[model samples]
Target chain A: MDFFHVLVVLLESTIRVSVPLVFAALAGLFTERAGVFDIGLEGKMLGAAFAAGAAAAVTQSVWIGLIAAILISVALSLVHGYASITQRGNQIVSGVAINFIVAGSTVILGEAWFRQGGRTPALAEGARFQTISFPDADMIREVPLLGPIYADLLSGHFLLTYLAFAMVPISWWILYRTRFGLRLRAVGENPGAVDTAGISVIWLRYRAVICCGILCGFAGAYLSLAMTAGFVKGMTAGKGYIALAALIFAKWRPKNVMFACLLFGFLDALAIRLQGTPLPLIGQVPVQFMQALPYILTVILLAGFIGKAIPPKAGGVPYVKER
Target chain B: MSTPYAKLPGWVEYGLIPLINLAVAFLVAGLVVLLVGENPLEAAYHLINGAFGRGEYIGFTLYYATTFIFTGLAVAVAFHAGLFNIGGEGQAYVGGIGVALACLWLDQTMPWYVVFPLAILGSVFFGALWAFLPGWLQAKRGSHIVITTIMFNFIASSLMVYLLTRVLKPLGSMAPQTRTFAEGGQLPKLDWLLSIFGLDVGTAPFNISFLLALVAAFGVWALIWRTRLGYEMRTMGHSPSAARYAGIRESRITVITMMISGGLAGMMALNPIMGEQFRMQLDFVQGAGFVGIAVALMGRSHPGGIIPAAILFGVLYQGGAEIAFEMPSISRDMIVIIQGLVILFAGALENMFRPAIARAFAMRGQRAAAVVQTRGA
Candidate 1:
């Protein structure tokens, strides 16, 4: 392959791999922007993945699978909302509980329903999301520099990939421009102020959480239906946590979230490509180091060595109304 | 929800409330079992029987409990300082390195007893070292302990995998683990302890580490309840501003409490490495650190409560395994479901029933006072 071809392949893989992270990071952004510490993002994604995979396999309809994913994820989001918002419970503990519950129940339910040892059956073509091709891609392929970039890098991708990228501007607009966006941000930073303004802090927080769930559901469906053939046990493999790291690394801004996820996704793609390949001075890079790079960088970012990551002021604290 | 009312008795506050939370958790777990088309009561019977049926079962249950106790104490210690050290898994992972290094260096020359103390020192040192960074970051750099510790866990997992596969694996072995330890490294099984009760120890890995865990629990209890440092930690936990006013060094106490918690989590390596596996392997911590969170929540962060909570989890784990074998439909993940519920009810939603309970007690107190007034009149 030529240099251009290899570059296109790498960039293509980067976009594909980062799609899930983008969705999840956006999901986390919505919740944290509303002052809810949602470590349960992983669980919601996992449960949705299982639900989507199972539904798709049984019904052979990708749309139905997507709907199932959304429903299950929304249900989990509400559980988190009820615990942290309505009950005024410890948000971190509730998030942790939700994570553990979904992690375990997904496998248990998968085994009971499928009998495939905690995996859904492989999805058929009708049940899986296929890549969409842009117009006139074949005729443009022979053209030199831009053809491969257009055809290979950007033109062909699952519909979700475009949507994931599209969500960046959409979320930016929603967070900064909309009325709900202002109140959500206000509630996170100062629920008391929001309350004094005659707004329901609890209801605003729940709406943000539900938005987070919807995004997470899309991320999960992308994982099981588009990225892979079917759901495998622990397939997310800490992607949820990485998205969280990306959120913190981006300082919880919508536009920065896209870049952070892409950066992590690029590193992942490069890691897979670089495995066992000898390099100058470094000899051969260990895959473990590459896998750990995102987390290590996130830690450094969190430590304020790179930049200070100031979370929403009211993050992790339950908002109690004073009589 | 915060109503100033009559103070609750010790039994109601410490005992009845926790039991109710636990019962509710189990009830939810039972509903999950029913959802899977299995009889919840039947599953419970199998679980209970599997944990306590045979002498071997009891041995295994205690063996699992031993690990939980160590990790649980680790969480409790940090919790008392108002720090949530979620890096127990990473600390314990690196602590295994400490145990492995000591065993590898002197297992052939030194006896088991000599190696044991050195191993303990090594585990504590490395484990504390692993936690010290996050603690330091939190204290000095104003980072969140939960986020930093979680990052450390992934880092620890990566570091251990690299060490085991490329650095520590024997010359010919393909597995990513060190070779089995010599006689000096292996801990002796406590067969005599079980034999005293006329129960055979069987093939269970119950060993002297059980005693070590018990001793550590006692030490933690004394440290948190008796020592001046313990008093400072509690004060810091309750209100950092108050602690600062009392001339307590917040940064110093935060660092010290984290190290102590990390040291206790590091000690958990003894049960799996020295007592059972006899060598370090990849991912040997195996979610035990997360289990500690649930145990601490259930135990209410008291060493007294942690012991029973640890054993109860041990029962769930052993029994869950039994159920997995007996009924293939219900996997071992059932225990994880139960664990999450326990943490949810006992920790996050702890006040779910408290308001009602408090209101009931307040009404009773008023009624008794009215009765006394009527009698006097």
Candidate 2:
């Protein structure tokens, strides 16, 4: 293939790989912005992926699978809310617990139900998400750059990819312009002030967590129903943690979160592409180094080599009134 | 959160609360077993029998407990200083490199006693060095410890994988492990020790590392409770501002505490590397490091409490394997679920039932007061 064709392929793969990270980072954005540390994002995504894959395998409908995934993700999110918010428990401990519970239960249930060594069966065509083609794309195939760009780079992606990219600006708008967004931000920074203004901190925090769950549900479904054809044990594979790093690197802003996720996704895609390919001076970049780049960069960024990443002021502190 | 059990008697606070929480966790786990068409009581019997019924089983259980004790103490030391060092797995992995190097270099020349101490020192040094950067970042640059430490774990795993496959594996070997250590570098098994008591225990992997774990526990207790540095670390944990006001350098304390924690975690490599495996291998630390978090929480960050908690988890692991072997219906993942339940109840929802217990005590006190008042009138 030509250089332009290679570039197009790379960009396409970048978008494809980034879709899940975008969804998960956006999910973390909602909750952390509302002052709830969400280390359990991995667990919720894993649970939803299992539910979606199993349900889709059985029902032969991706839409129904999506719904099941959302319900399960929301249930886990509510459990986190109950533990960290209502009970005033240690938020980190609760998040860690949620991760362990989901990680264990999904495997047990998956094995017991399917007897497939903790995996759902390969999904049927009707059950899997199909790539969406742009209208009349074949007609313009002979046209120069625009045709390939439209056909290869943009078109024929899973529908969730489009939704994931779209949610970025929508999230930005909601977090900046909406009244509920203002209240959510305020509660995270200073809950006492919000309570004095007569808004219930508990309800507002719950709403943010629910939004987190919905986004995580979409991420999980996209993993099982769109990106792959089945569920595997630990398929999320620390994507949740990477999303967390992205959230911190973005300084917990919606637009920055999208950028950070995409950047990390591009790095991941590059890592996959560069494997076994010899370079000029480096000879060949080891696969392990490429895989570890994001985490190492996260550590560097967190150490204030770039800029300070200040979390929400009241993050991880369970708010109590009249205390 | 201030423990709500502060007003309760010591036995109730330390002993009864954890027992109740453990009971509830097992009850829920039993329900899960029942859902899978198995008898919960029968499963319990199998678990107990598998963990402690035979001398060999008990040896394996304690062998597992030895590793847990090291990691648990690692976590507890950090927790005491307001740092959550979740990078024990990584530290232990890097520590294996230290043990391998020491064994590879000195085992041919040095005696066993000399080689053992040198290897222990090497492990502690490497583990502390791995933790030093994150601790420095948290102290000097105001980075969050939890995220940095977690990031370190992924990095360490990648590094270890690279080292094992490319650098350490001997020529023509298909496996990703170092060559076997020289005989002088290996630890003696505990079977001989048990035989001295006139009892024959089967050949188990239990080894001298268990005794090292006990020594480490005593060391941690003395360091935390008796030393001035330990007192300062606790003060910083309670209030950084207050610590600063009282002339304690929070940054120094942060670095020192994490190093010590990392040193303890590094010691966990001894059990699998020196005692049992006799060579460096991938993932020998397994998930014991994460389990240490649950152990530390259940132990209330005390050395005394951590020993028993570690043993309990060791039982679950050994017993769970037995259950998975005996019953095809129940997978080994059930043990993970049970571990998760215990972590949830003992750590996150620790005080969920505390209020009820406290209220009961309060009501009893009020009734006694009213009776005394009536008699006085």
Candidate 3:
């Protein structure tokens, strides 16, 4: 392949790998911006992936699988809301508990239903997501830079990838421009002020968490239905945590979240690409070090060795109104 | 505004509540078992029998408990200072490196007693150093402890993989583990100690490290309750601003608390490395560090409470393995579900039933008050 082709392939893979991270990071943004710390994003995504894969395999419909995934994700989010908000339990502990519960439940239920080593049976062609190509791609291919960009880089991606990128600007507008978004942001920073303005902090927080669940649902669905044929054990891996790190690295802004996810995705794709290739100075860089780069970078970012990251003021604290 | 359950006697608060929570968790686990087409009671019986039916089983259970106790205390100590140290897995992993180094350098020349103390010191030093950075960041840089510690776990695993494969793996061996320690470097099993009491443990992995765990627990109890440093740490946890006003150095306490916590977690290497395997390997820490979180939460961050909590989990681990072996339907992953259920009930939904119980007690109190009023009238 030519250098241009290589660049196009690398960029395409980066976008493909980053789709889930983008969804998950945006999911985290909604919750954290509304004053709830969501360490359980990993668990919710895992649950949705399993539900989506199992449903699609059975129903032979990707739409049905997407709906099943969202429903399960929302259900898990409600459990977290009830525990952390209504019960006044520790939010971190609740998130951690959710992670454990969902991680175990998915495997157990998957094993019971499928009897396939905690994995859903692979979906057939009609049941899985098909790539969407831009119209008249063959005719457009001779048009130089725009042609290659359209036909090679942008075309033929799973529908979820476009949706994930679209959600970035949509999320930014909602978080920055909309009235509900204003209240969500205010509640995260100072719930007492929002309550004084007659807004119900609990309701606002719940709405944000539900939004988070929906985004995580899409993220999980994308993983199982579009990126892969079916759900595997721990398929989300540490992406949820990585998305969380990206969320913090973005300083909890919607646009920055996209950039952060793309950066991580690029790192991931580069790690895979460079696995066997020898470099100039370092010779052949070990794959483990490359895989660990994101986490190490996240730690350094968090430690303020680079830029400062300030969390929402009321993030971990459950608001209790005075009588 | 005081709830009746909150006004319960001390024993009920500390003992009965946890017991009830454990019962609820097990009930949920049983429901899950039933859903999987197995008899819950039969599975429970097998679990209990496998965990404690024979002296050998008991020994293995205690051996598992020893590691849990160390990790649990590690979590509890940091928790008392209002810090969440989730990097125990990483700390323990690096601690293994320390043990390996000590054994590698001293095993051939030095006696076991001399080598063991050096290894213990090495483990403690490395573990403490691993935790110190995160604690320092949380104290000075305002970084979240949970995020940094979790990040460290991944780093620790990757670092170990790199070290084992590239640096530490013995030449000409394909296995990803170090050379076995010399006979002098290995810890003696506790068989002789048990035999003195006319009890046989049947060549279990139980070793003198279990005694070390007990001693560490007692030491933690004393540190948290009987010392001024512990007092300062508790004050800092309860109210950071108040602690600052009271002349406690927040950063100092944070660092010290994490160091002690990491040291405790590091000592877990003694059981798995020196006592059992006699060689360092990758992923040796397994999920024990995460399980320590559940243990500390269940134990309410007290060394006294952690012991029993650790033992309970030991039963789950040993018993769960037994059940997996006997039952074809229930896989090893089911044990994880059970563990998750316990964590959910004990940690997250700890007070779900508290208000109802309090209301029930309040009604009884009101009725007695009305009877007294009527009798007097």
Candidate 4:
């Protein structure tokens, strides 16, 4: 009812919506950093969402759903890897093909399996990721601002939400601190250099895509198992693209990716909130304009209207060893 | 991977290669059909029979091909210039706005003949405008065309939703679409043309747009194979560095090529909006732009090849609809799977079979050379 509460509520929704973007953008970070352009993130996520939803519905276990999602997503990532990394093919074209494949197959398979018009059955509570409540939330409720912020805004989120946030620092540490991170970034920038230094560019890129697939699996599982009750056809919508935009907007940095996703998520929440509300002076604000803002802003950012977004130096080019 | 292989004969290079790729794609799709518990042979029979069993069915297939031709040419033109114009979908969607505006303004007073030219211009203008930013950004600002064009697609979708629901929707109508066009706005169907072959089209929306698409394909062929601009585009496509060395303006060529591609993509709306739907609707493009990529890839980015490739997709689409009716388990998405496979094999893994083909040719050539040496001895 109060201003702070309304703000907290909006922020809470923002966090919820940004979870998938966070996971997806981080997934993209690994692949792109390792010199593999993955426009198929959307397809991978959608495939995993269907897999997770179907598995969860069948087994009534969220953990099984997560595992299934991972397996399916990883399979897709391998296809992309084989095409771009192994075949020396066009990365963009391969990614596009993957996207179209998953987009259609998920629906076809879902229909054949469930007969619910390309949707998995609605999942029971046990099949979905459960929300975890902070300890002593009832006792702490009387403490006014801090209590509401901690208990209401921060606590009572799906387990994946916490994991998604935790992934930020973990990803940052892996990207900047670890040995694998160094080789990964090095491969993206100069695969030839990495090759010269006795590192297998092909193997490193494969591992990065594997990492990408694992993270995308989490993102997809979170969508069907945590955010929604079941898998719906085309449910990821353009989140994968939005995640790509967020990655570019963030300049491919892990910390910036989180902020960019949260910002986009906030905009999405605002659009939903302002759907029918008339604003002062401007009168009715079309929700479409708000919805389009992220894409439009991304285009602008891509055009270097703001700061330039430079991808990895060797990104999108398939590496070939000199014979 | 960059090493050049033996040069292939013309037939093998163009015809046999694409055919093999198509066959492989279908084989994979057939396997998927088998996985779905339907006999693959039965599905294929139904698919073929559905596509060509009746004159009306052929009309429907060609009608679908009309849209593909325009989009395919769009992609082919861009391909000739080494630019991947993924904004075709967005361009086509926005292009409908031009056609709608022209129809809404002049359909009451003008004849279809008068409005048609103006609509073409308007569609091309709007579609080119949608692609121009991405093109210009790629040219001058070092932005990736793929990413920018993709972003434009989302923007166009959102923009159309707003325009249809808020601005274009007829008063009190629940649907998000414009008012139906008047007779002056509608394209005349090729009923008489079909009757010449003693085949009745039977409710098929095949119209003048099919002819227009054919003309556009011819135009693309001439432009790509004959004209000076086409030469520049092909040169740039093959080697940008060489093009730059040869004094071709890289930025100008990129922008112009994208505009031309966008214009061609935009013209695809004429088939659906004027020939079929008779009005602008949200999502009217309906993946045609994306299909253009497959068509271009399958056709090897030649207008001559694109026509047949476009018609093949037309078969898949029309026949897939029939399969959906005949076998409820095998949905239209099966056709989409075929499409994806075609793109994967024809576009991304295009050279998957090339090495083997090249080796076969190399061995045959070596044998011929040995025979010549033996004859000389």
Question: What is the per-residue lDDT of model 2 for residues B196-272, given as tens digits with 9 covering 90 to 100?
Answer: 76545576688888999999999999999999999998988888888999999989999999999998898899889
Q: List candidate 2 stretches off by more than 4 Å.
A: B2-6, B196-199
Question: Please, what is the TM-score per model?
Answer: 0.98, 0.97, 0.96, 0.98
Model 2 has an lDDT value of 0.89
Query: Could you tell me the TM-score of chain A in candidate 1?
Result: 0.98
> What's the C-alpha lDDT at position A213 in model 3?
93
> Per-residue lDDT for B210-291 in model 1, tens only?
9999999999999999999999999999989999999999999999999999999999998899999998999999999999
Fnat of every candidate, listed in order: 0.81, 0.66, 0.61, 0.73
lDDT of each: 0.93, 0.89, 0.88, 0.92
TM-score of chain B of 3: 0.95
TM-score of chain B of each: 0.98, 0.96, 0.95, 0.97
The candidates score, on chain A by TM-score, as follows: 0.98, 0.97, 0.97, 0.98
Q: Per-residue error at A276 for model 2, in Å? A: 1.2
Deviation of model 3 at B122, angstroms: 1.5
